[model samples]
Target: MAHEPAVIAALDVARPLVVDLGYGARPDTTVEMAGRLRRVAPDLEMVGLEIDPARVVDPRDGVRFAVGGFEMAGLRPRVVRAFNVLRQYDETEVDAAWSRLRAALSPGGVIVEGTCDEIGRRCTWVLLDVAGPVSLTLCWAPEHSERPSDLAERLPKALIHRNVPGEKIHDLLTLADQCWDIAAPLAPYGPRVRWRHAQDLLRERGVDCVVTRRRMSDNVLTVPWEAVAP
Candidate 1:
């Protein structure tokens, strides 16, 4: 959230409210996210929601817990982090879920929805606003990913089933693997460096990627949603 310009802009509003939709059986992740976001907007309101009413807990660490699902507990938040919430639902239900979540957002609000591996070595997410999905991002620990396409399993529900042949995502991943192989000589410099070189090669080949100068702990590739839309 702190790194993305659009996300930062959305949080730079008056009385910003952020929601951690479907924060799971524990509130640990919600509490941690509250602290991280507080650095960006200290006065921001944070809420953790769960569909199971029995799972709701008392407010703690500046985060309020409540019972909610894709409806978002009827609270329109400026930003919503809905990780791993849609994985359990059928792919056919993704659109309706997204519609519900989008409707629950405040004006100019954004949603970061995605899934990650159990150990979080691989992850993928989509950035969306009132205008709809803007970009798709793939993040993974370089050492854990033999090729960028290996993160395909972690793609958001909207794109997970679309990773088959002839799809834009399949094409992107194929090109990424090709780039990674072509950048093999950089392996001695470490997988992180090799991954960045692969991304650079991708850009040279006409892929529009969000290349960042700052070094990140994970290898990240973000491209406009249209680049990988099914």
Candidate 2:
């Protein structure tokens, strides 16, 4: 959620519209998103899209609803948040869905696709542009996490089943776990402190860790797609 501002800024649209793809039966998620986004972009609009016709709700202030899937209702959204939607499809279908959704993006748009635990403590998502996926972001509550690699269970579907010994994602998580162990001494201060040290270790080992000072304390890490691509 911290990166939402960056997602909005990248839109470059005066009255940007963000689509909550497959926003389930409940309209609460879409409504909350609009309220939060309006804090940054007052003119922002939110549209909730669901495959189930019954899930569509009446249009409300700065928010609307439509029945559609990957090929959305002919609306070129500046940002698409497809949380946990792809998990229901086979991994092989991901590319096709991404292509279809990417085609629906307006200029400078992006698709945030991924999954999170029930309580929303941990999350992993890919940031996709017209060219394809550019980065993978992992976020969690540092104090509640066991290790950096523990996020593996929350990885997006595209990479979740590919966490084998020789896979790139596996390699990254293995190294991250090792670094977390080595930084155990810093744990007394708090997990965030230890995580910062772990990140430094990752950088030292040539892992492409992208950290921003403003969000560093958020316990989030963004790495280039190539760094952990399967």
Candidate 3:
């Protein structure tokens, strides 16, 4: 499940992990998020902010349900994971949302915004900091491999619309696919090896890079914002 403890372990923890901009359609994910955080960071508190106040039920210790937007509810947190929360917004509005969320972060905070297929066969998200965009990560298991750019079809609201010609996101995605193609021989080494080789290739080719032993195991290749930014 997206909000499970194992999944939450991959996510960084903060004092108050807030799931800003949840849905009226379901609060189940928020509930799971709280449970998972308590497992990973025992002292962590979670707050779910829903613009639709009706969705927020009775609150308890370590978890507060509030009515707020993607801009944040005047709470500074270390981690904010907003999944499928911005799928409907216009691209132009994405920046404002990011600005508001980043502004509300506790200095070193990170915001992960993305969408996953109903079953999570394929998922992608962007990581941002106070300095602005950082990287776009497309996580997919290739049992159903199409072109890597198929994910371009599912870019976040900010980038989905920007996947056209002359876009940075477009260029970086293409580069990712190209890296995959060039690193095909490494596939014999295992997907993880091939991926690491591919990422190394990116850095060698001077794509601003960020890769760690921990991140690599997670199947994430975090590149510079300019490489895949909108």
Tens-place lDDT digits, model 3, residues 14-105: 45455545644666666676776666666676777888767787775556678888667777877777878888788778888888888887
Off by over 4 Å in 2: 2-6, 215-217
lDDT of 1: 0.90
Model 2: lDDT equals 0.85
Per-residue lDDT of 53-113 in model 2, one digit per residue for the tens? 9889899776999998999799998888998898888989989999999999988888899
Per-residue lDDT of 16-120 in model 1, one digit per residue for the tens?
A: 999999888789989998898888888999999999988899999989999888888789999999999999999999888888889999999999999988777
TM-score of 3: 0.77
lDDT of each: 0.90, 0.85, 0.69
Mark the 10 consecutive residues where model 2 has the least summed lDDT. 2-11
Q: Residue 58 of model 2: what lDDT?
A: 94
Better structure of 2 and 3 per TM-score? 2
> How many backbone overlaps does candidate 1 show?
0
